[model samples]
Target: MIELLVIPANQSQRRPNWLRVKLPVGKEYASVRGLVDTHKLHTICESGNCPNMGECWGAGTATFMILGNICTRSCSFCAVSTGRPLAVDLDEPNRVANSIKLMSVKHAVITSVDRDDLKDGGSIIWAETIRAVRRESPATTMETLIPDFRGIWDNLYRVCEERPEMISHNIETVRRLTKQVRVQAKYDRSMEALHRISEFGLRTKSGIMLGLGETEPDVIETMQDLANTGVHVLTIGQYLQPSKNHHPVMDWIHPDQFAKYKEIGQQMGFKYVESGPLVRSSYHAEKHLFDQVV
Candidate 1:
C-alpha cells in the first residue's frame, strides 16, 4: 500500500489576521443568496466552501460552477465532491445567465467540475453557458475557469469560439508534487491547455496553490513554466486541506510571502497577478484584469 504522508495538524492554520471574515447576514448577502436559490444555481462560494463567499456575495458577485457538482477527478486538496457526475442540466446555462443578470454582475466567472464521463468533457455546455451569459447581459465581461478537456483540442476549440474575456485552467501545484496533490491531472497537459488557449488569442490565465510541500525554487519554476505558455494572468494561493481525509498542508505561507510572489509574477511578465493567502483563482479576478484593461 502507498504510505500516506502526514504533516502537523496546524500546518494549515492561519494566524489571527488571516482568520478575519464577515458573517453572511447582511441585506446584500441575503439578497444575493436568494437570487441563487431562486434560480437553483450553484455558486463556487457555497459548493467549494470558499472563504470569501460572504464578502463576494455581499458584493453581488460570485463564481458559478456549471456542468455538475460531482467531479470525476478527486483532487485531495479540493472540497468539491468526487463521484460519477449527473447528466448535464440543459437549462443550467439560462439559469446562470438569469442569475448573473439579476445580480447585475458586471463581470462574471464560470467554472465547472471535471466531467470525464462526457465525450467532450462538458465543453459544449461551457460554450453554451458563455453564450447564454453574453446574450442575457451583452455588456458583462465573461471569464471561464475550465477543465483541460483532457487534451481534446476540438472540445477546447468549441469553447474558445464563444470569445470569453479570459480562459483559465489551473496547474494546481508544482510539477514535483502534482502527482501527489493532483492525482488525475498532468503538469505537461495543463501547460498544453494554457498554451492552446493562448494560441487562440484569448486572455489566457492559470493558477497554482502553494504550501503543498513545494519549495521556493519549485514555485518559481512553475511560474516560469506558466509564463512560457504565454499565459497572461496568474494566481497563487496557499493550500488549506478541506478535511482530515484530504491531504495535509505543508506550511501556512505568510501574507508577505504571497506579496513577494506577486512581485516575482509581475516581473516574470504576467499581465495580472493575484497572490495572497485569501486569493483563489476567481477571487477579485475581474477587478485585477479589469483594472489592467482600464
Candidate 2:
C-alpha cells in the first residue's frame, strides 16, 4: 500500500465548512458499486482515490475509466498504476454500456489511462465506447476526458467525430510545473490538443490543479491559454498528493481562492466552471455539464 502525506493544519487553521462530506453508505451507493463490479468496469473514483467518490457514487454516477487501469505515463500526483497495462478489453464498450444502463445514468463521464502502445492511441476504443453507451442508453449525455494522443491530430479527429456532449483533455498544471508533476506530458502539446478538439467544433473542456507549487499568475495564464483555444468548460481542483512517493502539496488553497478562480474562469469566457478544493476533473461533472447544455 502507498502511504499518503497529508499537510497538517496550521495553528490558525479552522476547518472549513465546505470540507465536510457525507460518508459513503446506503442503498444508492451500494447499487452503483455493484453495477460497476458486475460489469467489471473501473472508475476513477476508486482507482485515483478522488475525494468526491462518496458523493458522486451515492448520487448514482461515476467517472468510468476505460481502456485499462494501468497508465502508460507515470504522473507523480496520480494514484493509477504505472506499467505497460493489459491489452485492450474488446468487450469493454458493451460492459460500460450495460453498467450505465443498470445505474440508469442520465449522463456518463468516460475517461482512460494513456495507452501510447496502441496504434490508434485507443481512439477507436473511445469511439466505440461512446457509440455503445449511446446505443444502450440513448438519453445519457456523454463526456470524455482523454489523453493528449502524443499530439497526433488524426487520432483526436476520429474521437471528436463521435460527437460526445463534451470533450475534456486536462492540461493538468501550469507550463512550468508540467515537467515535475506530469513527467511524460508536454504542456504545449496538451494546449494544442484542446485547441484541435475545439477546432472540430466540439464542446471542449480542460482542468488544472492547485497546491502543486504553481503561482497565481501561472494559473491565470494557463486559463487564458485554455480560453484562447475556445474551451467551453473548466475545472480547478486542489492537488492532494496520492501517496508519500507522489509529489508534495506546496500549499493548501482555501475555498475563497477557489471561488476567485471560478470567477476568473467565467470572466475569461468558460461556459461552465467547477472550481474548489474538492473539485476533480469529473467531480459533479454530469450536473455541471447538463446545466450548461440544457
Candidate 3:
C-alpha cells in the first residue's frame, strides 16, 4: 500500500475529516461543565484545547489540571498559556476531590502545569491532590500527568509517595526535537523520570505528539527508549498547532500509519498503546487503566 501525506499549502491549515470532533452537547457534558465551573476547577480538556473534549466531557470524564491554568514553560507546540501562575491554591486538592466525588467518575485523570516557580516544583500539591481524591472518592482510580520537575528526584519522590494507579510524565516529542518542542525540558531527564517511576513498581505512562518534524525512525527510537525505561503505556497522536505562533503542523498522518504504530508499540512490549490522529494522553484513559493484555 502506498502512503500519502496532506501537506497544507499555507499556514491557515484545514483539518482533515479524521480530526474533526462534534460540538459538546448532551446533559452529561453540561453537568460536568457546570461542576467544573461551579467548583472553579481547571481541566486539561479546556486548557490544552483537546480535540476530544466534547466526546470526553459528554462521557463524564475529563483530565483535571490542578495548581493553576498558567504554565511557566513556553513550549513551542503547546496551547496552554505561558506566564506567571497564581499563588498555589492550598484548597485546590479538596475542590478537585470534591468535584470527582460529585462526578462519580470511576477513573479520574489529573494533570498540572509546570510550577517550576515553586521550591518543590508543586509535587506537594500533586501528592496532596491524589490523597484528597482518594479520601473523598476511595473507589475512583487515577492517573497523574505530571511535569519533569527538572529531574529533581526528591520532588518526584513526593508524587511517588501517593502511588496513584498510574503516573505519567510526557516526553512530548522525540529526542532530536526535545529542545525545540519543549523549550526547557530534557529528553534524557524525562527518560530518567520514567525509569524512577518504574523503579517504584508503579505503572509508568508517557505520550509523544507526531508531525513535529520527526522521522519514522525517530519515533521508533523514542518508543524503544521509553520501553527501556519500563513505560507500560504510550499515546501517539498528530500534532495540531494551537496557533500560528505555535509549531506548525507538517503533515496530516494517515489513520493507517497510526494503526501501524500501535502495532509497533504493542510488539515493543507496551501493554496498551493509544495511537491515532485524535489520540491524546488522557484519551480513553480508563481503558488504558485496565486493559492489560499479556
Best-fitting candidate, scored by lDDT: 3
For residues 188-248, write the lDDT of model 3, one tens digit per residue. Answer: 9999999999888888899989877777788889999999999999999988888899998
Residue pairs clashing in model 3 are: none
Tell me which of candidates 2 and 3 scores higher on lDDT. 3
Stretches > 4 Å off in candidate 1 = 1-16, 24-30, 37-40, 290-294
lDDT of 2 by residue, 9-112 (tens): 44324444566676688887787778777776666677776668878887766788899888999999988899998999999999888888887877788999
Model 1: lowest-lDDT 10 consecutive positions? 1-10
TM-score ranking of the models: 3, 1, 2
lDDT tens digits, residue span 1-294, model 1: 322222333743544356456566788888887877887766777877788887777765688889878899989898888998888999999989998898877778899989999999899999899989989999888789999888988999899989898898999999999998888999999999999989888888888887788877888899999999999989998787788899987776777778888999999988889998788888876665544321
Quote each prediction's TM-score: 0.90, 0.89, 0.92
Over 4 Å off, model 2: 1-20, 25-27, 34-41, 290-294
Backbone clash total for model 2 is 0
TM-score of 3: 0.92
Question: Among all windows of ten consecutive residues in candidate 2, which has the lowest summed lDDT?
Answer: 2-11
Candidate 3, which segments miss by more than 4 Å at Cα?
Answer: 1-12, 25-27, 37-41, 291-294
| Clashes within 3 Å, all models in order | 0, 0, 0
Q: By TM-score, who's the top model here?
A: 3
lDDT of 3: 0.86
